[model samples]
Target: MAGKLQVGLLFGGKSVEHEISLRSARNVYQHLDRSYFNPVLIGITKKGNWHLLEDIDQSIDSAPPLNLSLGHSRHTFPTVDQQGGTGLLDVIFPVLHGTDGEDGSIQGMLQSVNIPFAGSGVLGSSVAMDKLISKQLLKDAGIPTSKFIDLTGQDISKVSYEQIENILGLPFMVKPISLGSSVGISKVSSEQEYLKAIEESLQYDQGLLAEQYISGRELECAILGNTVPRASDPGEIIVSSKYEFYTYDAKYKDPHAVEIKVPAVLDHLIVEQIKDLSLRAYKVLRCEDFARVDLFLKDNQTIYINEINTIPGFTNSSMFPSLWAQHGISYSELITKILHLATERFESKKQLTRDYSGN
Candidate 1:
């Protein structure tokens, strides 16, 4: 591992998507180029404990529980033994998804520690994690998105079904604003379902977003780089009819529940539009390194931007990598490219001065 950059792969958090993060991290660790990058596995338990795994191949489910208190260990950053030739992490590649992982919490912590990590910075991650903020920003930027109404736990009690129906109409989507992987998201077609969906969503997040449901194809495009970002070929998520939508179960648990079509069957003009919009959204969000921008394509070819996933799933089968793979980037190369982007961004930031003095 001499002369190789050590990459700490951080995953598995106290979020609902913790299991998904484990799967994503496993794929990232397996695909990371050992000759160029030394991968360090760091797992955060469900109870918010961080532990460095001695063996990367160990199953997260079977790994012995870590009883250490939070922030008790100063070794969050792994060190290298020059004499023993063990690699020390030069950068972090967080494969964590949702809540604490993707919501700028971890990004801010890394910033405080002055460590380089891949993906969007704190501002971008925080904004993107909140659907209300992201949708408003996108709307303000003239990016097309489904109309949504923001609601809090207290607002739900005063809000009537008739009021919501008059504003958003039937068959809308009720979701916990900050969560991903379709957790606590439900499609409401009836008054009873609407009430239940809102209550259920509140369990995960205090903020809720009820979006106008646009009946159309679920599309996704992958974005990469910082200053001049590139968008990959758009992909389509084909969910089984059995499922109401791309639920958490559909995305992970149920095999054959979904099919991903890279370079989605569409006119060349439409494809270009999707890519263009994807890049615009990435820039608007101030996203760095890599992200997956989901969109909805209506029957008339009208496109509406869905939320952006700062750290989309990284499994080989995940949409982000699969979309890039269509553009001739293998999973391993994608991981390497992300690492390079992380270093590039870090170096660029290092050039900035923290304090200014009058000359």
Candidate 2:
């Protein structure tokens, strides 16, 4: 490759979904087109250590987070690239799934250094990560989402399972407020399940989301773009009878646990409605680059917004890339387009800044 852009492929994090991140990163790395770009593998360990891999197959090791000196000039690291000397990175493509990576931490770090990266910015990342906040905003925007209440501090201590059963009803979903990959999520239909669910959820986050369980088909829509985002044909997740819901095991552990149908079978009008709702939810969250919006389609032809993933999974079986593939964009083409979008957004922002010296 000659004069190719260096893409820093980042993945892994200090989150419950660390293993899932690794799978996504590896898939993304493999699918990345080497002709147009040179992949710089930057894997982070579960303990939050950043490593510059010599090759794609390099394993992660433990260390502390990078200590950067934020001076006046642009912050640049030495010997971080593949070559011995300093080489400017064109863009960073993060496959990190949850917590520090997806929840605005990494986004903020990139933004602080004025580096171009794929996916949503800090505000969108943080808002979409917390289910409690997202539900409120979606409801305010007139988007139909299941009713839910946040349990934090006094609410966490005072609220009882009986109260939730009465308010939302039996068979509600209990989730860690800011997590993904179905980690620390439980569909509770009993007091026993509720207690265990909350305790398990608290292990992941200080807050919990007790959402009403809407009985419907599970659908997901993958969105792409910044100003005028487009939604892919909706996909359906059919969880087998073995699992009560799409649990972590159903998502990653057991391949036979669920069936995923891209461009999910539906009427033409229903597909349009799903696309409209997904776009609305994406814009409401101020999502940029791309995201995956989940929804619940009730039998009455009504739909409810579930949640949005800012940095969705890029694994071989992930619905995001799979949904776009149906639209004729292969895995390599989709990522290449995403990186171009990242650079485009970065350049546009830089031009928008006029030296405000007169005023």
Candidate 3:
């Protein structure tokens, strides 16, 4: 392993997507390039404890996603020396999504240690993870999003039933201001469901985003690379059940919960529009490496840009890889590409002039 790059695969964070992250890490670990890279598994438990895993499979029995205690790896916070030795990581692929991992917290830490990782930087990841802020930024950038309001802890407590009813209106989407995997999301149809929705939402996030639910087809496009990023053919997500929207169970559990139509059923022009919008949104947020941009298409084919996942799911079943596979890129190739992008970004950052002194 002298010349082989020691790649750190970090996953299973203290977010709702913890389990999903574990599944993704397992897939990547089982598929990464053995010739050029030596992938090391770093599992972070739900309590925000970090562990260096010696045997990845042994940790599967732990209840809370991936547990470091189960593996030979000891626990530590987010750092290179968490393995209890010199920080020898050549590159970090943070597979965690949603909160600490996706919201720029981990990015900032990695930056401080000068380690190159996959996905967006602090600014891009932070903005992309926040639904309310991302929506505002998109709106400012001329991208269409549903009408919404940012409800802080103060605002949430003071608002009355009538206030909630009149302002956000009923049959709306309620979710944490910055979360993914549809963790604390709910669809409230009446006053009876409004308070419960808010209560459940508060469990996951401090800020809340209550937006007008758009009735249309759900579409997604995978964006890869930086500066001149490329977009995969659009994919449509159709929930077969009578669920108000695509919830956590619909995305993962039920086998027939949702049908993903690859090369989405749409006109070439509409596909081009979605691909372009995906790129625009990716660039606007200053995202790097990769992202999965979700969109909503109306009956007339009008497109509204939804949120972008800076570090989208990369499991074999994930839409991102699925879309790329349809375009002739294998999963191994995708992983290699992502690793290359990480190195590219790290090298570029190393080239920047960070010395600031009066001369």
Candidate 4:
């Protein structure tokens, strides 16, 4: 392919959603325009190992090999189609989710290698991945969000029962600050389940957040941009059962457990409001390329910004691409737009003065 952009798709990680990442990557890999992109499948195993998959179709036939020390690897990871000669990566598409992938770890590695990557930078990714910090940033930006208090593992373990109840209150959501895909997240209706929930949450992250559960419809908006960002139509998550909330299984495994309704049922004014707020949150967080802004729309029409996912899920079922699809942007077009934004952002960052010039 002449003049084709070589895209290195990095997926899978040392996270609970590693399997989901594989599914997402494979779907994207197969759909990417071969004419415009030389799609390279760079698989990262669950144990955090990175390997260049020679034949993606054949590799899919076998179980993925685990890479326990991806972070400790010495030689630079080879790009796809490097069998005959060295393959230089033009841009990296990180389709990974949760923990090491979405928590700014992978982004940092890409930065160190001096490779252009899609999505937010280190600060934006790390900030958006942590629920506690994201909420604080939204609040600082004058955006309404659920009431929350940061609690570390040590703090949760040592806090007196009365103190925990007094601060967190009842019917609160205990979440691991840095994890996504609903892992290590629990909703507690009373103090009796507080300790156990906190203990479970600590298994995922050191920092935790106890947030007042704002009852409302779960809404999400997709944002795409280089400098000026555009927000997509809002989508809603509808749960069939009267469960506590959207859990891990309901999100990926159980299809009947939840339904994702695009252009979510809402007043035209409310839809506009949600879309506008989503773009605002994206700018405040300094998210580049793309992001999915999730929010809680209360019955009283009060909109509370939830968290933003810098590297949100990219499968067909994912709200980010799906929302854009509803706005007449097809999946292939969405990918094209994101790649263009990545190049645009990389070029913009190159404009900064790196070497100091003495007057």
Per-model CA lDDT versus the true structure: 0.87, 0.86, 0.83, 0.82
lDDT tens digits, residue span 1-359, model 3: 35887888988888888989988898889889899888877888877877667666747324233222222232222333333454366788999988899999999987766678888999999999989889998999998887887777788767666776686666788888988888889988877787898898999889997887888999999988986899998999998756778988898887788988887889999999999998999888888999999999999888998799988887778899999998999888898899999888888877889789978
Q: Sort the predicted structures by TM-score, highest score first.
A: 2, 1, 4, 3
What is candidate 1's lDDT per residue for 46-111, written digit by digit as tens?
877676676766755455443322232332344332233333458899899998999999999887
The estimated TM-scores of all candidates read 0.92, 0.94, 0.90, 0.91
How displaced is residue 40 in candidate 2, in Å? 0.6
After the best TM-score superposition of candidate 2, give how far the Cα of residue 180 lies from its true spot, in angstroms: 0.9
**In model 2, which regions exceed 4 Å deviation?**
62-87, 354-358
How does residue 94 of candidate 1 score in lDDT? 87
Per-residue error for 172 in candidate 4, Å, reads: 0.6
lDDT of 2 by residue, 271-296 (tens): 99999999999999988999999999
Clashing pairs in 4: 49-67
Query: Mind giving the per-residue lDDT tens digits that candidate 4 earns over 1-359?
Result: 35998898888778898888887887778778777898877777776666666565545324344232233233233343323344566788999998888888888978876678888989899889888888888999999998887787567657665665677677788899988888999998766787788889988888988888888899998999957789987999987666679889888878788889998989999989998899999988889999999999999999999999998888878888899988898888888888878877887887999999799
TM for candidate 4 is 0.91
The C-alpha local distance difference test score for the whole of candidate 2 amounts to 0.86
Candidate 4 Cα misplacement greater than 4 A, ranges? 57-85
Off by over 4 Å in 1: 59-87
Clashes of each: 0, 0, 1, 1
Candidate 3: pairs in clash = 52-73
**Best by TM-score, which number?**
2
